[model samples]
Target: MVLISLGPLAGDVHLLNRACKGAGTHEDLLTEILIGRSNEEMFLLKEQYRRTHNKDLVQVVRGELSMKTERMFVMALTGTRDESTFVNHQQVQQDVETLYRAGPGKIGTDEIAICGILLQRSDAHLAAIAQAFPQRHRVSLTHMIESEFSGHMKDALLHVSRGAEQDGQGVYRDTQLLEAAMAGMGTKDERLCYRISRYHWNRPRFGAIKNQYQQLYRRSLRQRVEGETSGKYEKALVGIIEQN
Candidate 1:
């Protein structure tokens, strides 16, 4: 695929439309574009999609995806989520209780409810939620997640929780994402590419991400990729990581 320098919103809509084309959808392409975007960016992309294709972006996504993936995309496009905002202690407490009853406090995990709260709130709000959680419940929110869920769901919830917590100007979430891509046996190349592609153009943000990755893992992200992959693929990954 030739990557042209279209404007951000226009480029995103173009990729999304391409992903939705005949046969089966390019799910990795769709996920990489949608999941990497901010709520405000997604809102603009939806409008741009309508102008470009005469169809709703959410409708297009729904037609192409189902279940959790569909829900994630639709929620992203809704643009109701907060980004960086003052913590609402009262609401945070309520959310904590909601999560408690949904997960550790209950027999079965309420995946929908837990994810609903995680997805809608801003990272700052989620940090507040994580802080307040231990006061209400004996375990930390991360602990509860580690205990209550398993497999991909576990990873997703953890991503939501950890992504909410930012240290200084650095994004700790990128460290977690990098770990996820490298965890277990083989590399999750699609996820790795998504994360690198997501921030490669934003020098400061990507720099912070790289810094946090080193802090968390005791090695450079480029080093880890070098150790895990080879040939042109390795070169490409390292190039993206090193790019300004």
Candidate 2:
């Protein structure tokens, strides 16, 4: 694969189209791109998806997923998440209570209640919620999602929590995704390409992602790439990540 780019936003629309167009949905691709995006970025992605495919990204994603997972994406697609950095501690406490009652407070999880608060809140709000959740419930939001949900919804919610905890720059989330692309076995070239291109358009974020990867894994991203890949491919990945 060439790891082509029309920039991150454009490439995202294309990757999403490809994820949804075929018989099999690339759920991981769909989840990471859809979740954790800023409201403006989400708006542009939906607009671009509509322009490129003449299809609403929401409906397209809804068609691919079912039940709670579908609703999660639908809620995010509204592009209504509060973007303000102001964290109303009162509202954060309220959200924390709602989340606990929705999941741990009751026998069956109230999926909508959980999704609404997480998906619709700002990162500052989410950061407060994350801080308060464990303080109140004694378990992290990540663990709660793992216990209360399954499959794609779980993954998506975990993405939301981790992104929030990282202050919503998504450095940790991107670091995990980037490493996931290169982990376990043969490299996932297409995903690796898409992920690199996604951030390469923003040098600062790309560099932050590399730094975060090193912080988490104790090795530079370039070293890991060299271990897993070779020749021109390795050179390209190393070059992209090693940019000063």
Candidate 3:
């Protein structure tokens, strides 16, 4: 099947206004946008929304959505993938630190968030997260779950974080990535949307990105990032991982 490059179209306002005006619910729109569409299709859809609606599409959907469904759709719409592989690694490390710092009762939100982020990464990165969890926190991630989380949430989190080494390891080459992003003629226009989009959908990496903040600018990558960029593009350049 051809990959969709539409980039979060269904979530935009034209479609969303239709939903908001009682044409269809947000869930219906989300299904159309995220399911069985190529990235190009998603990108085009977002553009269509912007043209038709003066307001940002994501805001429209978020204004209406709630709970888990909201989480899923908003994540789809944010769609920021312009990041370095090493930056991703650094993000993972930062997440681990956040997990370690949080108290037991405070672990749930951050824990699930990290797991969600990690899901977007390759097996290689997943393994690293799992391995590092215990070493950094002085307790196994699994044990943390057993003690803190329960039921399906616990089960799901464990499954996603099981092995990171294979996850983020072999998928993309760092040198080639840097070359493509920086050394090429299109460097100024470069966007690592693939990596961010991958992680946005990827549960594990999404979780990690929430708390991890190690961008090239020496700021939290999360703080530096702004979804659906318009001006200056500082969000794209500041958060990329530096090439060693």
All models: lDDT?
A: 0.74, 0.84, 0.47
lDDT of 2 at 208: 82
Q: How many clashes does each candidate structure show, in the order listed? A: 0, 0, 58
Tens digit of per-residue lDDT, candidate 3, span 117-157: 54344444456666777777777765665676554344444
lDDT of 1 at 39: 75
Number of the top-ranking candidate, with TM-score as the measure: 2
Best by lDDT: 2
**Is 1 or 3 the stronger prediction by TM-score?**
1
- What is candidate 1's local distance difference test score? 0.74
For all the candidates, what are their Cα RMSDs to the real structure?
Answer: 3.9, 1.7, 15.8
Worst 10 residues of 1 by lDDT: 1-10
TM-score between model 1 and native: 0.73
Which digits, one per residue and each the tens of the lDDT, describe model 2 over residues 85-150? 887999988899999999989999999999999888888788888888899989998889999998
In model 2, which regions exceed 4 Å deviation?
A: 1-3, 166-168
lDDT (Cα, 0-100) at 201 in candidate 3: 47
Per-model TM-score versus the true fold: 0.73, 0.93, 0.34
Q: Which stretches of candidate 3 lie over 4 Å from their true place?
A: 1-45, 48-56, 67-76, 87-91, 100-127, 134-244
Q: Ten consecutive residues with minimal summed lDDT in candidate 3?
A: 170-179
